[model samples]
Target: MILEIAQLQVKPEQSADFEAAFAQAQRIIAAMPGYLGHELQRCVEQAGHYMLLVRWRTLDDHQVGFRQSAQYQEWRALLHHFYDPFPTVLHYEQVAL
Candidate 1:
């Protein structure tokens, strides 16, 4: 599986609104092809910071399958505006322990 992590910096005053929007946005992503699951975590020390972790069957499942779909536009419309400088997204794979 591919783990997608997003570092989100929301506008200070709009954290509550951002969370609300994400509640709706999550449904959209969850319905996408190859979607495994996800988590949204708020920072303890930084009130306006959030970490979004998503699991996909493959990296292309996110980078192409979801991001390229029309649903992504809806996702962007719902949650994009809440960001300040915008979020940074990265992908990872499990390593043997």
Candidate 2:
């Protein structure tokens, strides 16, 4: 499985809208073929920061299947605008027991 971790720093005033948008976005990603599951959490210390964790059967499932879908365009339009300076998305392969 491929695990994705994204740290997004949203504009202070846009936090609520960002969450709403992300919820809608999650629906799109969740319906894809290789999706496992995902979660989004707000940082307690900093209200405008969020953590997006997602699991996929393969990296190509995300990079090609989901990201290229039309649903993603709408998702990007809604949530990407709320980013303060853009998020950093990293992929990982689990190595822990």
Candidate 3:
């Protein structure tokens, strides 16, 4: 599985709106191909900061399948405006032990 992590920093007073938008946006992502699951977590010390974790079957599932789909436009419209400097998204894979 591929793990996608995004450190989201919203504008100071727009956290609530950001969360509300994300609630709507999540459905779009959840319906994409190869999507496994996702979670959004708020920072304890930073009110406008959040961590988004998403599991995909492969990196292409997120980068190409989702990002290239028309649904991405809706996702962007719903949640992109709340960002400040914009979030950096990275993908990871489990290390065998």
Each prediction's TM-score versus the true structure? 0.97, 0.94, 0.97
Candidate 1 C-alpha lDDT tens digits along 1-97: 9999999999989999999999999999999999999999999999799999999999999999999999999999999998888889999999985
Off by over 4 Å in 2: none
Q: What residue pairs are clashing in model 2?
A: none
Instruction: Show how many residue pairs clash in every candidate, following the order shown.
Output: 0, 0, 0
List of clashing residue pairs for candidate 1: none
lDDT scores for all predictions? 0.95, 0.90, 0.95
Off by over 4 Å in 1: none
Instruction: For residue 40, give model 3's deviation from the true position in Å.
Output: 0.1
Model 3 agreement with the true structure over 41-87: per-residue lDDT tens digits: 99999879999999999999999999999999999999989998899
Q: Candidate 1: lDDT of 27?
A: 98
Worst 10 residues of 3 by lDDT: 12-21
- Candidate 3: C-alpha lDDT: 0.95
lDDT of 2 at 36: 99
